[model samples]
Target: MAPAITTLAAAPELSAANTGFMLICSALVMLMTPALAFFYGGMVRVKSTLNMLMMSFISLGIVTILWVLYGFSLAFGADSGSIIGWSSDYVGLSGIGVTELWDGYTIPVYVFAVFQLMFAILTPALISGALADRVKFTAWALFIALWVTVVYFPVAHWVWGSGGWLFEMGVIDFAGGTAVHINAGAAALGVILVIGKRVGFKKDPMRPHSLPLVMLGAGLLWFGWFGFNAGSWLGNDDGVGAVMFVNTQVATAAAMLAWLAYEKIRHGSFTTLGAASGAVAGLVAITPAGGSVSPLGAIAVGAIAGLVCAMAVGLKYKFGYDDSLDVIGVHLVGGVIGSLLVGFFATGGVQSDAKGLFYGGGLEQLGKQAIGVFAVLAYSLVASAILALIIDKTMGMRVSEDDEVSGIDQVEHAETAYDFSGAGGGASSRSTAAPAPAVTETKKVDA
Candidate 1:
């Protein structure tokens, strides 16, 4: 029997309420994947919009199956020295259906298992934003499978599993500040480096094709994030409720103001793109510290994330890497800001016993947070790079230039997102609707 099982058997009263609450939280978290689809779908060129949506939506299917098969076992199974999980509990999900209590909470183990499965589904999909336009669909599907197995599973073990080094070291990641955000962010940077810039990256004025779709995505993400962060508490207690509610408002208001303010100052316009990006940045920043800090801390986290991510998104210009949709800028940068800030803002004055640098706890907490950050970054980057290389060498990761230009919707999926109802011979209608920009005038930085 696993150690957690033994401990759980000793204290059965702690399982029921927690398990029920977590089950609901897990379902809420799952909705974000579709929300992500809409968010990314609207950002790409119209020709590839459907393709982008598929990229995010497909993960829900692929990762869900894998999580049941072996992903969960590798992540939360019995520990093997904190580096990875041993599948001694392989497919032992058979007995998990029993009404058992664990961790001083009474709930079926299956509830916890499914809750975590939603996260596994979303993490790899987040990286898809970085490689949006050029990658082959089959290649991406295969890449995520291998990437999750090699990178995500092990890292998750280190942070959440029993006997994991980070867990034993007292590193606090409240949700997935490092595991999901930073890990995806660094991996995005690595992939974009290996893949090179997208066609017409800096020179093409790649405006979002649909602002409404972007707003739709933002709304879904906001709604689902409550489950993502508060669910970490794994119970329906007052603490979880408070965290969920506060996380909702602080992130929204902060991002809305920050994005508009920055746009007015820099570009003399407040674009919808800025609004969507800022909201996501705030959400990312608040994720790690949501449960541990006060409302004020949440606002600070959101404001800083919005501003820092906005600045970081421009790095693609100077550094010349095409993070197609700013996954690295928003998720990775925001995640780091939140994680580090929590070190100084976790004033236990609110609920927990933890305090931050400004709260008179000194740099001890900050040091620990930094260490956790580095360890996660190093592991994720190296592991993800190897996974990418192996997948590239073994199968290939990109599509042909002709296929890309023709659009993955028609070429890859054998379908199109729209049809002009046979009016004006299709060709004339498309050409007349909007003339393609001349080669010299393409806006690359916004792509």
Candidate 2:
């Protein structure tokens, strides 16, 4: 009886590597939140830069606490018919100490919990880009808290958690193709539709305020993505190592070339924004298939992602929807492209268990991939629309026109990013003072 009990208590080693590696992966995943802040922050007008940053930053604090409380249970707890977690064993991380056990790993369950927490933080932040500059901060906060609970958690359970329908069906997401990208993309569309367009979305130039800021954000996102994709392996292995290294170079180069080529062809100049946007497009495209495809396939995925997302961004103009920062375009379209392409480019000649078109596996795998994409899209859109309506009715989602024109940074946060020198040179002068003085200074300098 003693020997049997000891054997039952022993958990398999999660990975072959030591705790140091898992710790690093955890840290890498954590960086993605801040990286996302920079990525989204740079896309909006100057008036709402801080607001964008705040959206991403708040997730780090809020979601981490929620994950500890019951978010993990709802997401990864003992599966409840693959729709949600049933067990509350990890609520408040109870019994999840250094000695706690999980599938194939001897590491503390806390490491797994922390890694997943970062993902939860990022998913809601992804939607914030679509609602930038218009939504009330308090309302946005509450909506995110509720959105994760109602939309994100269940989808996560359905895809990644045990007994999930998609999992049971044997869909190959590899790393959140359906769960994260498709889900976020669909929700972004829903929120934008309900929130309505930003003031002068189509008519106004609405240019990105700082190209440098945009590039910086893109760089951080690219860097942090190493953890986002590679860390999903959750262990140090040859496969994970190769995926991490190749994901970095293939995506960087493919996106850079694709964007520049597109810009040169269409606009006659390769703008910095094009470079940054292309990089992100590549990153999004590779996310779903990075683990399954070869390096050459990765390049194909990234290059196509860049071009497809670039074109998809223009859809808002043609269709008359204001996806403020093109979240639907880059994430949704790129995700679809990646998910489908893997059906053709996957190794083993596409005839084996997971063959792609190029591997002679025919179209069966492609059909399966398409099914996964459509399923996630339909479910996320409807659910997100319902959730948005609920929040709108309960707490109000958008700010008034007056507050919007005054700039969300000031109206919402009561702070401004810049205070021009020599313009408000007098004591007691505030930002509200007329710009006539600054205009005069500018004329004098020009002269």
TM-score for each candidate, following the candidate numbering: 0.89, 0.89
Summarize candidate 2's per-residue lDDT along 115-196 as a digit string, tens digits: 8788888888888888889998888888778778888888888877888877777666766778888889998998888878
If candidate 2 were superposed on the true structure by all CA atoms, what would the RMSD be? 7.1
Q: State candidate 1's TM-score.
A: 0.89
The alpha-carbon lDDT assigned to residue 32 of candidate 2 equals 76
Q: List model 1 lDDT by residue over 1-447, tens digit each.
A: 655543443545545567767887898899999899999989988888888999998899888888888888888878887788865444645545366544345656677788888999899889989887788898888878988888888888888787788877767787888888988888887777776777778887777788899999988998898888888776765565566468657965796678778878988998888998898898888877777677877887788788888888999888888999999999889888888987988876544677888888888888888887888888777777777777777777787888877777888788877776775756667777866777866667965
Worst 10 residues of 2 by lDDT: 438-447
Cα error, residue 308 of model 2, in Å, equals 0.5
Summed backbone clashes in each candidate are 21, 12
Q: Which stretches of candidate 1 lie over 4 Å from their true place?
A: 1-10, 14-17, 90-92, 349-351, 422-447
Give the Å error, residue 306, model 1: 0.6
